[model samples]
Target: MQSDSKILAKINQTVDRLSDPESYDLVCHEHRLGEPLPSTEKLAKIVNMIREILFPGYFGTTSLRPNTIKHYMGVYVDELFELLSEQIMAGLCFTCKNPHEVDMQERNRHAQMLASEFIAYLPEIRRKLVADVDTAFVGDPAAQSQSEVIFCYPAIRAISNYRIANQLLKLEVPLIPRIISEMAHSETGIDIHPKAEIGESFTIDHGTGVVIGSTCIIGNNVKLYQGVTLGAKSFPLDEDGNPIKGVPRHPIVEDGVIIYAQATILGRVTVGANSVVGGNVWVTNNVPPNSKIVQFKARETSFSDGAGI
Candidate 1:
């Protein structure tokens, strides 16, 4: 055991190191007085509340039936509005250059308006989620029912979160949308950027190690397998050598396209409608519509063929 004096000295030194201005200058979050930063934990609860609202019996409180559903929805909607408004305001204040320069009341009203707009879109969001659930059921032979897809599928969990976060991003709510998507990403091992625009009737099979980049526009009825990467080919450097931001870096996957496991489709290319890209293929160019791309046959090797080269 260390001596008490040694422990105090060590703690003091650690605190001094942590508090050094140079150490924290770039990464520390700065907020104004009386302004609340977005809370990841609270945002997580909000995501859960959304799932509960959308799925009803499958997600939370299965005791609810047809007769009592309306009352439960009303209560959940009220609670969601309150929670979402606060978090949205927190996100706005967090991203503000100087919170004091803005009028607090108008900002609060704006947050309320955005929150109401999001609430209005919830039914549509739920409708799309039903399509996703049905897709998952049809895509996976192991799925016993649509209820099984909702109850047992991690893809549904991740995709539902992406949809919610995408709508939040569309609403111009800032940091909170990324955080909400990341909450699902951490749990599901599916890294879908909240800014990615994925359409209806999408499903992923065994959805581990899937990465969808921001600016990716996925069309309807698309299915992707595990270990797929829809990523940028390379960054276009600016005059200062920093990569230019928001220049449409990812792929535009058209309707009914299927990218298989470990396939790498990069850049702002288009995987044309109804196309299928085979597993382990590296695609960096546009694929024509209705094409099926697969790997070439492996050549047989012999000692006389100089295969070592």
Candidate 2:
């Protein structure tokens, strides 16, 4: 008991020191105010709850009937709206930071409105996501059905999270979009920044190690294979050699572009429409429309037909 009390005392002292303005002045200047929310697990559950509601029988309790499903969804939607409203309000308050002005009521109203708007978009999102499911099905042979993809595929999981996060981002709610994507990242090993403009009919095949960075503008019907990275080859660095923040650093893949496995197309370069970028290729320059890039003379062999020493 004595040791526990001493440990608690030490933790309190450390927290107090951290809370001191002077002690944290330099760091605080670099970072700003953002009140922490519930854990990512909690957020993930909320997201999954939303998914279960949106796509009935695909996620969460599978035993629900079509009749009872709406009732369950209404309950989940209410709970999600409540929790998301609180989190969004916290985000707004954190970002407002005026200190002299804190309008919690107005922020709450806006948050509620945003939540309502996001809920309204669910049907359209589902419609677009159906196209994604079709793309995935036609793109990959292993997928049994749309139901299988919805229930088991990481690509679907990641895409679902991205769509949800993208809607929140469009609503201009800060921090939550990134958190939602990072949750999908943790689950699926695919890192798609919420700010990346991805179009409908997008599919990620065998999605592990696929990274779509911020500023990546993906057009419709874009398909990416595993280990493909649409990232910047080089960042515009500051005087201190740190990469400049918020620059357009990723590729803009035009519509109908197929990026195969392990292909790294970097920078603000535009991959023109109907292009096929093959595996293990590093592309920095702009690819012309309908261009096919593949490995050349990369394989080595020794002839065994000749009678040699």
Candidate 3:
């Protein structure tokens, strides 16, 4: 071990290096003294609360009888306002370049108002989730019941989180929505961007390695199997040679389309309505409506070994 004097000197030097503006400026998020940053832990709890409120009967241990449901909903909504408002305000602060310049009281009021608006959207979210659950139940032969789809399916979990995060993104609340989607991505291997516009009755079977890009627009009654990637082929660069943001890049899956397992569709191409895209095919063009796309059949080969080699 080193002497105490050397240890003290090393500690002081490290502290000085960390505190230096040049050394820490690029990596550190310089937050204001009183402004709170978004917490993944709190957001996780908020998601659980939303799940409890959305599907009261299935998720937790609580009973949702006729007499107790109103009481539970009332209590959950009241508590959600407090927690969600804090997170929204934190998102606002995180996105702001000058947090100290913002009027915290006014921002708090705005956050609360937005939180209430989001609470009102719960019914609509539930309606969408119901359609998704039904689709998953019917699409997969292994799914025994709607309850099984709701509770055990990773697609439901991922889609539910995506819908919630998409609403927040529409409300123009930053940072928190992406964080929420990332929570789902971590729990299930389905990576859906918060900004992606996905329509009703969507189902993903065996949802692993699915990447739905930022600018993707998926229509109603669309189904995607495992390892399906809806991504950007390439990005248009700016004057600085950096990729431009918010350009339409990913494929649009029109209504009634079924993209099978391991299908990779790229660019702003539209996969037309009622089409069937087969497994493991790479597509970068617009597919006509009611069309079927599949990979070419492999040639049959025979091996001659019978101990005569």
What lDDT score belongs to each candidate, Candidate 1 first? Answer: 0.93, 0.85, 0.93
Clashing residue pairs for model 2: none
Give the top-scoring candidate (TM-score). Answer: 1
Which model is ahead, 1 or 3, in terms of TM-score? 1
The estimated TM-scores of all candidates read 0.96, 0.85, 0.94
Model 3, which residues run further than 4 Å from truth? 302-309
Runs in model 2 with CA error above 4 Å? 1-38, 62-64, 237-244, 299-309
TM-score of 2: 0.85
Shift of residue 134 alpha carbon in model 3, Å:
0.6
Show the colliding residue pairs in model 1: none
**Residue range with the least summed lDDT across 10 consecutive positions in model 2:** 29-38
- In candidate 3, which residue pairs get closer than 3 Å at backbone N, Cα or C atoms, i.e. clash? none
Q: Write the per-residue lDDT of candidate 2 for residues 159-192, one digit (tens) a residue.
A: 9899889989999988888899999999999999
- Evaluation by lDDT, superior candidate among 2 and 3: 3
Better of 1 and 2 by lDDT: 1
Which sections of candidate 1 miss by over 4 Å?
Answer: 1-3, 304-309
